[model samples]
Structure formats: structure tokens, C-alpha cells
Target: MTKAITLRADHGSDDLRRLARASRDAAQTRRLLALAAIYDGASRTEAARIGGVGLQIVRDWVARFNAEGPAGLVDRKAPGKSPRLGPEQRVALVQAVEAGPKPESHGVVRWRLVDLVRWMQDRFGVSVSRQTLGRELRRMGLRKLSARPQDQAQDPEPLEAFKKTFPPSWRRSASSCPRKPLELWWQDEARVGQKNGITRRWARRGTRPRAPHDQRTTWAYIFGAICPAKGKAAGLVMPYANTEAMQAHLTEISAAVEPGAHAVLILDQAGWHMSTHLAVPENITFLPLPPRSPELNPVENIWQYMRENWLSNRVFENYDDIVAHCCDAWNKLLAEPTRITSIGFRTWAHGS
Candidate 1:
């Protein structure tokens, strides 16, 4: 029964039609075109037909257009329900996750979404679905990832000290090496064999995908090294992991170095790596990492990448086939030098 709101006098049918054409939002364009019909002296019923809505919606659009112009017609995100977890609750959740579950109390080694949901209900009397909890966890910058391996016997004190002293040692090694330039190389070995494990693959939701899993024992060792800064690598597909193989790998790595550059090869101290019988290369110096710390070397990640992409889920006929596959995988990795740079690069080892 009340009078309809007046639209802004500055915009005519032509102006509104132009604005409608320029608008990216479909709903906003519809509202603009409906208002244009009104400016053209069309009945409210006609404008409602243009908007594909009832007269009430057209009247609401008219009111919005009269108040704030075209922008007011644009869609606004709906204000949903308030957060289920408060600031204090969020802090508590982070602490509980970091501290991990007490096996005696929680009866689980790891925290799962359902387990966390139960925990929230028991501790704070809050009810949340797994999907909602997942969304909240992601919003809090958390993700489910495989945990890195850490030896129980690892001495944290020396490891921390070693990390702190890395820069000084790096500088000393650079100064000691006889070359105009220096190359930092990470070295490690991985055993690729017929007993290869399967990797994850994309599939439809609620369906599981499978890959070939071999149980044969035949294996080949990949003695690999990468100079991340140069995006270059040197490797040898060896039959065994011993002093002889290590010597051969060191020689290969030395040869891969630039003509005038000395390489500081950072590697873990295996028995062969520390063997006095192994001849040291003139162009390369060894920087042995602390014991039980394979994670310190980026070459471990290179091995993981190789296994996931090329070497996994396959059955090799024999030792020869294993060797061939290892070589092929290494060659494929070398072909993509940028992949080496991306996978092997460490900010601390390389730079900012």
C-alpha cells in the first residue's frame, strides 16, 4: 500500500543498461536491467518479470538502488554462524596437537579428526562435524603430513650446536678449498629394488586406486649427489654400497665440478664414507653430517622424489633390470635440472 522508493535521478535507462552490460555479477546485472525497465516507464510487474522475481524483490532492489546505486545491488557474502572454537579454545587445540596424545589416556598413537571431535566434546562440550573441523584446521594453517624419521638415540644438543656452527664451518671449508669458486653439493645413497612400494594416485572419491607391488629381493644402489645452486647432479648406479662404491661416487662427483671450482660435499658418515683407505679427491672435500641425521641432507628428498615419480610400483626382472631402472630414473631427474633445484635447494645451505 505504501509508495515505491525513487531511484537516483542521475541514472536513466540508458545509463543503467550500460552499467548492467559492464557488471560481471549476474544478480547485479539483473537488478540493474530491472531498474532500467522502471526508468523506461515499465510497470513494476514488468520489472519483476525482467528480474525473474516477485514484486517484493523488485521493490527491495529499487530501495537498494535508491540508497547506494549499482554497488548496493551487488551480492554480499552471507554472515554465517559464529566460530565454534573461541580464541582460548583455539590456543588449547594447538597446544594439545603439538604436545601429542598421551597413549595411556587417549589410547591412540596419533590424533585423527574423529578422535579430536570426541576430545572437543569431552573437554569443552562442543559438537563439531569432521568436515567443519577439517575446515577449521586448514584455516588455522595446519595440514596432515607424514612425520619425518628421527632416531631415538639422536643427541639434540650436538645437533643444535652443529646447526648453529654450520655457517662458520661452511666459511672455513670455502676458505680451505683450492679454487676461485666453490660449489655446495649434497650426497646420499638410496637402494632401489624389485621390492618397490606403491605411491598415491588420483582417483574418484570413495574409490581406491592400486599399483603393482613387487616382492623380489634383487636391488641396486643409487649413489647420488646434487649441487643445488648450479642445478647439476652426478651419480652412479652401483651394485653395492661399500667403500669401493663410495670412492667411485666421490670421483664421479669430483669430475662433475666446474674446471676452476672446488666442491664441498656434505654427506652422512657411514662406515665407507669415513674409511681411511678411500682416496680423497683433490677437487672435493668431505663435510660429514652428525650421526643418525639423514634428514639434514636434502639428497634424501631427492631420493623420495625419484621413488615416488619413477622408481616405485614396478617389478624389475633381475639385478640388471634394477640397475637399468635406477640409471633411467637418475637420467630422467638430470633431464629436469629445475626439478633438482626445487627439490634439493635449502635456504640455509644455499642462501635467502
Candidate 2:
């Protein structure tokens, strides 16, 4: 009769239990528990059940643990197939995404999925599906996003100047750790209505489920700001996002902050935001973002998050319904302050 495998005494002692308790990796913990069980005279089948893996996997893990110590339980790189694109081809692709297609040379105004696919085929002899290409682009931290309006003739000197004076400046360290608390509140305006956008959700296989969108083509703008240190959010809902509404929002934000503490608002240079008629509060300052750069403002992240989590896939009867739904979302999001802090905190301006 064939016999079952058992782990070594040294590897599966109380030390193994200590390692398991201290392990952050779930896979490693399971492996340690399985080994400890086996060392305690449990059958291979029993150990496999405890580890939530097949018996063969438990044996493989035991062998690896014997060969190297707790480190052996860490996930090893899969010896999979080599990459489709060569080194030079990947560099070319990255450069193309950064610089965009050359208008004069490529005779293309902007790059579409089909355009990128064609370019890759012609330039690197590679064929990639749209979905696969999207995955690769995401892996490279690139997204195919629709850009906001940018004035072509706008000078970038003022935007750079505003950055130098970022107050409560807390710079992140080389290890991506945040420094001192920054009093900067990220600010942005978003319009939500029956026309709110949609995101992917689970639906019956081979069937599509879609909510009413842009039905009334109406919207209510919400001006929101977040202080990461406090994890507190303040918002003003208004009929419009023009100069008057912006001033009102600023007034509300100024009131929300502590007395005599200067608050810096990092915002894009919208006409209403930078308009001469807009009143600048004494206790507040504006840090204008660079032209054509919407990604610089952390508040942009809140808009997408709100849509996805609380506001998407809804049907509103009237404009009042739209306002109610939108405000409810904002209130719910703000109720959990940690979510706000995690999404909108970026401290890179104050550095030596």
C-alpha cells in the first residue's frame, strides 16, 4: 500500500505557527497551517482540506518550504511565455501614447483604437485586439480618457507660478509616504442628473441591462471640497456653476475651515473660477492647475467614484429627483470620511 507524505519536524514546529500568525500573505499562511497540521500527525488529505488546496499542491508547497524556509512560500514568478512585443517595440508604443500621433507626419488628428492597432501592425509587426491593447495600456498606467476643453493660446506661466506657493505644503517621500498634514482642499464641480453616465455591472449572461440616461438632459452642479487630514467634506449644490455659484461655493468652503487658518484650493482655470467678477475670500487662496491638465486635481477622482458607487444606473422622474439623488450621494460619500481622504489626498507641493 502507498504511504502519505509528512512535513519535516523542524519546519512544522511551533515556529511554523508563529510564522503563520505573523504572515501577511494569505497563501503563505495557508501553507504554514497545512504544514503544521501535517507535522502534528494529520493525514495529507486532512492537511489539503485545511489549506483549501489540492493534495498535490500541499505536497508541492511542503517541498518548497523544505528547500527554502518561510520565503519559499512566497509566490514565485510563473515561467510563462515571453512577451509579444520586443523591448524596442514597447518603448515605441509608450512614446507614441505620450506624444500622441504626429499630425503632420501621420496625417491623423487623434489616435483611436483602430488607429493605434494599425500603427502597431505597420510599425512593429504586431496584432492586438482592442480589449488586449486596453489591458496593456492600463498596465502602463495610461487611460483613454476624454480631455476637458483647453485654450490653445493660454500661457502656462501663471499656472507654474501658482504651484510654487502651495500652502501647508506637505511633500511625499521617495517611498511614496505622505509628509505633514496639508490644509489644501481639492475643489471641483460636477453635474449629475438623469443624464448621469453608466458603468459595468453584473447582468444575466447574453443579455444587456441599461438604465435611462440623458433622458431629460438636465443637471444640477455640486461644488465639493475635501480636507484630507480631517476626512471632512463640504459641498454646495446650485442650479449653475457660473461666477455667482462659484463665489457662493467658495464662501461655504471658507466658512467650513477653522478660523484664521489659510485654506488653499487647487483648481483648474475655468472662466468662472478665474473670472474678475468672482469674489476671492480673504482666508482662502487658489492654486491654478496647468493648462490641459485635469489629472492634477485630486477632486477629479471624487467625481468618477461618486458616479460609480452611489449615482450610476438610476432613473429620475424630474429635476427635483435628480437633485435629491445627487445630494444623497454626496452626503453618503462624506459620511465616510476615510474614503474621501484616500481618494483626494495628494501632498507633493511642499518640498525642500
Candidate 3:
């Protein structure tokens, strides 16, 4: 014999009705409707039909509601379904990923999701989904990145020694002139052409924007220098990136500064930059970066910014158009000294 189920003393027909209306959870709404129907004197069979569940399920739900109220009727994770990795296990997993897998032992070049899944099970008797492993990796500051390999034989001591002594060494004679603050300019050269290179862009989902590859072959080398200390920039476009062009760029940079004011120029040890006929101006001093260390150059980032923004995915009709577009981009960049300062300033640079 099934006893009649009634609403609790604190709750009325209005309360049950409100619960059914307010609940966003469809499963919770169904349970509430069933309870409401029973309170309205409906039979058990009728309540089951209204709740869209079998009579036995409805009975089970009624028992839960009676034991724990509305909260009891809400869905819950199944028992023993919690994550396999505990806090300590998670920390261990992070450490293992950071160390990276040994190719000799792991028999793999890199850690893929499946590879990690197997590794976890082997190391800790834990089973984690690929998605779960990825989330854990991200939490521990791991990310997918393009790696540029450096030679193991190359020594980094020289680069370290150069950065250590550069700043205070320059400041010794940098502020001698009153007209200009110490203008520390980092210089780099880039080639802009008709085929500017492909980059990502927003488009309709499941569709790709195809660009015509019939771009002109002609290109021009652009030499640019950004002075963080003075919030200034100087650039020149030439047909070649040789000693003569570099000398011209250096002259242009030297001329842009206040008269009688000397400037410090940080540059990479490229052949053209070190050429005998480079003709470095008397007011400009060149500080060559360590070998194979373009990352230490702030001007390198400017090339990336230009390629990613104005030059990418653009097909110029002629060499003249490329020059015009590049000139416009540099003009826009030059007008925004704050942008230049923000992007160009490095901790090793004067005002960083």
C-alpha cells in the first residue's frame, strides 16, 4: 500500500509551482512538476506520466525529495566517478611533463595526448582523459609553441657578458649633451615584397580565404631603428641591404637626432652591419649583439609586428605599391611614439 505524498508544511502549492517555473534545469523542473501534481491530488501513475518517467523512477524520486527536499532531487555525479589524479598526483604529473619524456625510454619524439595518457597510467596507476590532461598541462603553464632549435655547442657566456655591461657603460657618456636624452636605438632590416606572407584572419566558419599568388617578385629592404629613450623612430627603404644601404640608414638615424647629441645603436653582428665601408657616423656608436642572438634585439619584434599586421596576406600589384604600403605603415607607426616605446622598450634598453 502506497501512502499519499504531500508537500512539506513550509511549502505550499504556490511554492511547488514557483519551483517548477523558476528552475532552469529541465530534470529539476520535471521532478518539481511531479511533486506539484502529487500535491494537487494526482495518482502516482498520473504523476509519473507528467514527470515523463516510469512509476518506479517517480517513487525513487519521491523518496529522495522526502529525505533531502528539492536538493535531493537534483542530479549528482555518480559515486566513484571523481578524477583519478589526486592533488599530489597532479603535482607529480606537472613535474613529469615539465621534465619532458626521454626519447630513448618513452620511444617518442614529443608528448601527445595519448602518449601522456599512457604515461600517467604507467607512472601513477591513474587514468585521465586527453582533455583532462590538456587542462592540467595548461594549469601548469605548459603550452604548444613553435620551437627554434639552438646548437648545443654554442656558448651563451658572451651574450650574458654583453648585456651585463651595456647599460651603465652607455650612461657614462650618454647624457653629456643637454639637448637630447640618451637616444638608444635598436636597429634591424626586413624585406617587404608583393607576396607579403600568409597570416590568420577572421572568416566564415568551415571556409578559408584564398589569396592570389600572382604577386610581383620585386621587393625592397627596409631599415628601421626605434629610440626608446627619446620616443623617436627612423627608417629608410632601399633596394639592397648591403654595406652602402646600412651606412645610409646609419647616417639617416644620426641626422634625425639633435645636433651635437650622440646616440647608442644596438645591432646584431650581421655581415653588412660589420662591413668595412659601413661608414658609421661620428655621433652614432654601434653596439653589436652576441653571435646568433636575434632574440636580444628589440627591433626584431618590429619586423614581426609589420609582417603580422600590415604586410601579411596582402598581394601588391607592383613594387611601387609595396613601397607605398610599407611607407604608409611606417608613417603610421612613427606618428605613434607611445606605440613605439611600448613595443620597442626592453629591460636592457635605456628607458625600459
Candidate 4:
């Protein structure tokens, strides 16, 4: 073999000296230590020992340094495989998603992962696994979200405008007199059990058992209110949700408040609440919630509590049964007005 190449001392080279001193990296320090050992007349074995590497590794580093210098010791850029989809293919995929799901794929109505993967193979002639497709979709900032069908007419602007005006309307005295305490009330109709369902099963001394049948029932609305201070709540069940129904609920609520107190009825800007036909007593003013912000209404909490505590898993045989159960739950809410008020006041109290 030819004579083995070795790093001779460049004692006068300021660049090498600066690189040795200024470098703070562990790998660079190790390499410099090995070089220093070699310059000090140590054997390759001793240099490898000082460098905490095998002699072969030390020799490799020495060879790299001789060929490409210190810069060569840094990591090289890793070359990765190209993506399965080209620019045109990715654009096509986005267009298909925007166009919505297609039928004849099956009885399936929605674009599920497996369906999309199959579609990609059929439409683009590009076969990709579900996991890979999911990753690609996410990389393109796509996410699955649910929305109400387009036919549902959701008018939120008036409700929003009312919410903004409500607090100020309540804060200002209905009468110019400053002595009257600020009395606020919320009125709304809550559906009791429109989506209630039940499964009924009967088993005898058993041959093959028959399948259980499901039962469903609908109930009317509960129009109600809560005073923020006393945790006082009162409401009534009505056959229909209309201005007449709302007027009756308001009349009951107005009767309950202390005499001479100005009351503001906080409610959503529903057609009935804003109807010209429905008359309000001079002491009772209406304040509507901001558009699309149902969470801002404290009375909603009472309805939620009722649903969770008494209504969710229970089955009512008829509308009358549901009405009775709702009345009982309403009474329980009335008994704890402080709780109702605490919940109602949360929106304003939290600066929300």
C-alpha cells in the first residue's frame, strides 16, 4: 500500500486556530481533540481513544477533513421522495371536495375517508391508502365540520342588535326617577321533548325473542323567566308558541315582581316577542339577546338543567305527562332562585 496520509501541523494557520477555539459544538470539539492528538505525535489508536470513537471512524473523519475541510463535517441535506400528487392532481382533489360528494358511489350520502380514497382511485387513477389520504387532506388544511341543512332559515341579526341594546335599556331607568331599583326578567319558550324516544321490550319464557320497538312523543313549550337576585323562577306550559302565549307568560311574570319596580324582559328577538299585537304593561320592557348568542341568556341554563336532570333519559306517555313532569322540574328551579340568578348573571358578571 501507499504511505498513509496524515494531518501535518499547520501551527501558523490562524483560521484553524480560530475554528478550534471558537467552536462550541461537541462533535467539532471531539474532532479537534483527535487532530490535536495527531499533531502532538500520538498514534491513530490514541487519537481515536481521545476522540471517544473507533480508529476507523477517526480515519474516516480525517479523510473527510483532508478532502472537504471543516465545512464537510456538517450534516448534508437529506433527499426525500416526491409526493404522490403533482400540482395539477392536488388542484383536482380540492375541486372535487368543493363540488360535494357524488351519488352512485353507494347508498352512502356523505364523503367518508374510505369513500374518498376509493373515489381518488376511480377518478384520478391514483391509488392511495386511507392514512396517506387523511394526511394529504390535513396538509391541504381540510377539516370535517357539520352544518344545518341550507333550508333552515336562521335570522341572527335582529337578535344580535337586541342583545347589544338590552343591557343599556335595563341600566337606564324606564321612568326618569332614579329611586326605582333595576328589575330584569328573561322570557323564552323552551321545547320540552320534541325529540324524545324510547325502546320497549317484552320477554316471556323464551323461544326466539322478538325485536324491541321504539316509542316517540312530542310535548309543548315552557315559557319562563328568572329574577337575577332572588334566584326566583316562574313559567307556564302552553299548547302553542305565539304572541298570545308569550303575553300570558309575561303577564304571570309581571304579576310576580314587587310593586312599583321597573322590569325588563330579556328574550330572543323572536317574531312573537317583537310582534306589534302583543302589548306590554308600562312597568315591563323587553330586552332581546344579541343575534346568534343563545349562550348569553341565563334562563337557557334553567332549561339545560331541567333537560339534564329530569328530561334526558325519562319517557313520558303523553303530552299531559310531560307537562306535569316539566311543572315539577320548574317548581324545583323556582325553589332555588339564587342558583338561577347566579347562572343568569354569569354573562354580565364575567364581562362576557
Candidate 5:
């Protein structure tokens, strides 16, 4: 016959009562109640009944409590399998990954899971499963990364030099006077898609009208300058985007700004804006935006509106059609200076 078990008041003081009261979760409350009952001179079976758990679970808890004290009764570490790769093997695996794949022996463009497995087998004479290798890679913080061929061949010197010399600042001289008039100026480029389509509904009940499709054409590039306060704008549509094309666009913008007493031309860090090929005019000052921050440009919102409202649904047959439509949209935007100013000041409101 099995020996009869007796419970004793093992928990010191009234701490278990406080724990039972403080426990919010149902499972935790039950566990604390069971422990409290066991501590209050109840049998294991009696404690299990009060706790609403099995007798075996109560006995297990008591055994754990006796073995490793109160912490042992709370929870134990999960039983998990040990890692296959030893410390030395793990270090070797990291070294192999850092060295990259050997193309001559592996006969592959890049390293794959199977290739890694094979490489490890041949190089270290240790056979490792694909799953094990993947786990090891993950443990070592290795992630899938791609490299472009051009990125490998790029020279950093020219880019560094260009960064250093461009955008030279000139302080206002004491003798210099402000120009004719002051205007809030904005300069930006927009792309026109030559091939575009529009969807329409027909009068017939069951069928929808299909719009014409034009695939051979593309959108014209429009470089525009606008005054927010006066609602006046000047723009030039061109075939391509380059320093020469931008210089031509700037020529037109310079004439417009010539009448303004103060002009601030807000433009992005495009290649044309920073190119050494063009000379910076004295009257017109270029306000360079921080790199890659397109959200700060209000002209972006104008282009977004233009695309969604006017250009999105309509289909154009050729470049000429695209240019005409874009010019019309540009004129319409110029007519609404408040809208432009509101959109431009979006970031400004948020302390950008």
C-alpha cells in the first residue's frame, strides 16, 4: 500500500494570502489558492479539490517545492534539445559565411542553403542538415542581402569631391540692394506619361465602355516655378531631364524672378540642381532640400493632386497630347495660389 501524505503550513507568515488576493488571472489565482491550501495543513488531494486541479499536479508541485523551494514550485525551464553545433563549430560556420561562397569549387553564382550544406561538408568534413545550417545562420545574425554589380565598381572619391564643392554659400554684401519685388517662389519638375488610359461607363445596362489605349507615347517633363502669394506661375515643358534641359528651364524662371525684389527658388537635390555644368545666377538663390525627404516638398502634393484628379483617368495618344494636358493642369494650379500655399506649408505647421 502507498504511504498516506500530509500537508504542513510550509509558507511562512501571511504572504500566500496576499499573493492569492493580488492574482488577477484565473489560472494564477487557482495556483496561489492551491499553494495556500497546502500551506494551511490540507492534504494534497484536499488542496487539489480547492484549487480545481488534478491530484497528480498537486503532488508534482509539492515535490518541486521540496526539491528547489518556492521558485521551483512556480515554474521550471522548458525541456528543449541541445544545439548540434559546438562552440568551435559555430565559430567555424561564422568564418565560412564571412569568407563567402567559393565559386570555383561550388560552381554557383551565389550561395544557397544546399550549397552551404555541401560547402560545410567538404570544407570542415562535418555533415550538417539544411535545417541545422539555416538555424545556425539565423543564430549568427545572418540575413539575406543582395549586391548590385555597379555598386561594387563605384568610385567614392568623385562623389565625395562633388559633395564638398557644390552649393557654395555667398553672404549678402553691405552695398547689395534687394531686387524689384518679393514673391514666394517654388520650382519643381513633373513627369507626363504619354501612354495613359481612361475608363468610362456606357449608357447600356450590362456593358461598360472601354477607353482607347496608347502605348507608344510618354509624358512630357514640366519644370515649373510658381508664386504662392500672387498666384502667378511660369513653367516650361521639355522632352528630357538633364543639366542642359534644366538650364533652359532656369533661363525662363530667371526672367520671371527678375521682376521680384526677393526670390527663393525651392528645389530638390536633383542632379541638375547640383550639377557643375550650370552657373548659379546672382539674383536667383537655390534653396536645397534635405536629401531623400520628398514629403517636405509641397510641389509633390500638387503633382499628386494633378495625377489623381486630371491625369489619372485620361488616356493620351502621344507626347504632344500629354504636354497639352499637363500645361493646362499647371495653369489651373497657378490660378489657385491659396491651395498651393496650404499644401506647401503642410510640413511647416508640424515644425518640419
Candidate 6:
């Protein structure tokens, strides 16, 4: 027979009963009341019966209460199975995620959970399930997100430099434009056509929902520009993506600029945009983003928002129908100015 550990003398049976009454945790309250029974001169067997546990468990509880007072009675999270991946393995996994898998070596463009599991087995001789690896990735603060499209020939250095220098450049050019208030506008062109894509839709688990997709090639260009700060937008639906169409679009943008304010238009270095033949308005100045860096333009996001919300999953009857749909979508977008601000605002360009 083991000797019982002496509980702390400061907390008596009355103190424990009072604490038990006040305690919110039901398990903690039960343990406290059982200990109160023991404090009031009840036998350990009687205390065990009060706690609904065996005598050994009662003894264990007494040991814990003696060590840590009422807090010891509280339920603790059970430490489950140990992680299969060690610290060094976790670091390696993070590195692998940051530096995406090579297509030639990994035989896949993207790293899937199964691929990672196989890689872990090959790299460290540890077997982990996809579900477990997913848990680990989530624990590491990694999530699956859609990748942004970038041109193959894009220069990362210039793109980074452009973002860094954009604020100062805007300030300097803003003074030269000689407008009381300068509006920053992001410009881009998207093709809305009969050849429409199917976007994601809500459906029951393990079931695929179908949407209308078109194969016809007829399309029209939407020359779109947005001032995220003011939640202002200008757009033109055009038959072609040429200097004439660009000129028309620029004029429309110029007309749309607020009274007594000049527009500093940021755009990609498209041929139609940079053409010497096209006459730029005095109220608008061109600031071309680095070549092949479409991500720098917020209008890209606007196009994506429009396509996802309104333009996608539809079949157009003809060129006129495409134009009408494009107009309707753009108008719907303009109706919600806050949507424009939310979609197009960039901290790098607009500043806090």
C-alpha cells in the first residue's frame, strides 16, 4: 500500500467547496468536490466513488492536487502521436514549397500532397500520409492559392524595382502634369468573345457542375481604366485592338477625368499605346509599366473580377451580342464603385 501525499494546508474543505461552486469547468468542479470529500475526512475509496473513478486514479488526482492545487484538477489536452517529420525535415519541406518543384525532375509542374509524401520518403526515409502532410503544411501556415500569370520573359529585378520606385515616380510626374489633384489610373485591355470559359460554381461534394462554354472565335476588346483611389472608371468597347481604337479609348479616358484634375495613366507597353501616330490628351500622361509585367497593372484584376462575376459561363449569339454583354458587365461594375476600389486598390501604388 502506497502512502497518500499530503495536500497543501492553506485550502481547506470549505475553500475547495467554494472554489468548486465558482469553477466553470465541470471536470475541474467534480475533481474539486471529490478532493473536498477527502479533506472532510472521507476515505480514499469514498472519494473515488464521488469522482466516479478507481482508487489508483483518486490517488493520482490527490498527487496532482497536492502538486498544483485546484488547477491540477483541470483537464489537459492529450499529447497525440509524435510528428513523423523532424525539425530539419520540416525546414527542408518549407524550402521545397518556396522553391517550386522542377517539372523535368519532379515530373509535375506543381507539388501535390502525394508527390510531397513520395518526396519525403525518398529524401528522409519517412512515410507520411497526404492527410498528415496537409495538416503539417497548414500548421506551417501554407495554403493552396491560385498562381498569378507572368510572361516567360519577365525580368524579376525590373518588376521589383518598378514597384519600389513607383511612388516617387508618381510624385515627380504628378507635379509635371500641373493638375491641382492628380488621379492615378491603371489601364488594360481584355477580349470578351463568343469563345467563353467556364468558371467555378457551387455544387454538392464529389459532384461537378457544368456551365456553358463557347468555341466560336469572334471577340471584341474592352479598353478599361480605373482610378482606385476615387473609385472612378473609364472604358470603351472596341471592334479591334489597334492604334485607332487606342486613340478612341484614350480620348474617352481623357473625357472621363474629373474637372480641373489631370490623370496619370499607368499602362503596359502595348504597340497601340506607344504609337507616335496616336494623339494623347493634355489631361492624361502615360506611365508605362515594365514590359511583360502584367501583374503591375490593377486592371488585370478588374478583368479577372469581371470575367469571374459576369462575363464567364455564357454563350454569345454574335459580335453584337458579345458587345452588349460586355457593355452590360462594365456598366454593372461601374454601378458598384466600391467594388472597383476594393478590387483595384494596391498599397504599393496608392499608399496608405
| Residue pairs in clash, model 6 | none
Q: Which candidate is the best by lDDT?
A: 6
Off by over 4 Å in 1: 1-78, 174-179
All candidates' lDDT scores? Answer: 0.89, 0.77, 0.80, 0.72, 0.67, 0.91
lDDT per residue for candidate 4 within 247-285, as digits (tens), equals 898789888777877776777778998999987876677
Identify the runs in model 6 with alpha carbons over 4 angstroms from their true place. 1-42, 174-179
Task: Sort by lDDT, best first.
Answer: 6, 1, 3, 2, 4, 5
- Cα-based lDDT at residue 262, candidate 1: 87
Greater lDDT among 2 and 4 belongs to 2
TM-score of each: 0.78, 0.58, 0.67, 0.51, 0.48, 0.89
- Give each model's clash number: 0, 1, 0, 8, 7, 0
Give the per-residue lDDT digits (tens) of candidate 1, residues 1-352: 8787777898999999999899899999999999999999999999999999999999999888888888989989999989999998788888888788999999998999999899889999999998988888888888887677888899888777777778568657868754468889999999988888788878999998888888778888999999998899999999899999999999999999999888888999999999999998988888889998887899999998998898888989999999888999999999999999998888766545
- Stretches off by above 4 angstroms in model 2 are 1-85, 97-120, 124-182, 202-209, 268-282, 286-293, 350-352
What TM-score would you give candidate 6 relative to the actual structure?
0.89
Residues 8-56 of candidate 2 have per-residue lDDT tens digits of 5565457888999999999898888888887788888998899998978
Q: What are the clashing pairs of model 2?
A: 195-214
Selected candidate, larger lDDT, 5 vs 6: 6
Candidate No. with top TM-score = 6
Model 6 lDDT per residue over 1-352, tens place: 7787776898899999999999999998989998899889998889889999998998889888888888999999999988788999999999999899999999998999999999999999999999999999999999998788989988899999989888878767768655378889999999999989788889998998888888999999999999999898999999999999999999999998998898889998889999999899988888999889999898999999999899999999999999999999999999989999999999998656
Error of 3 at 175 (Å): 9.7
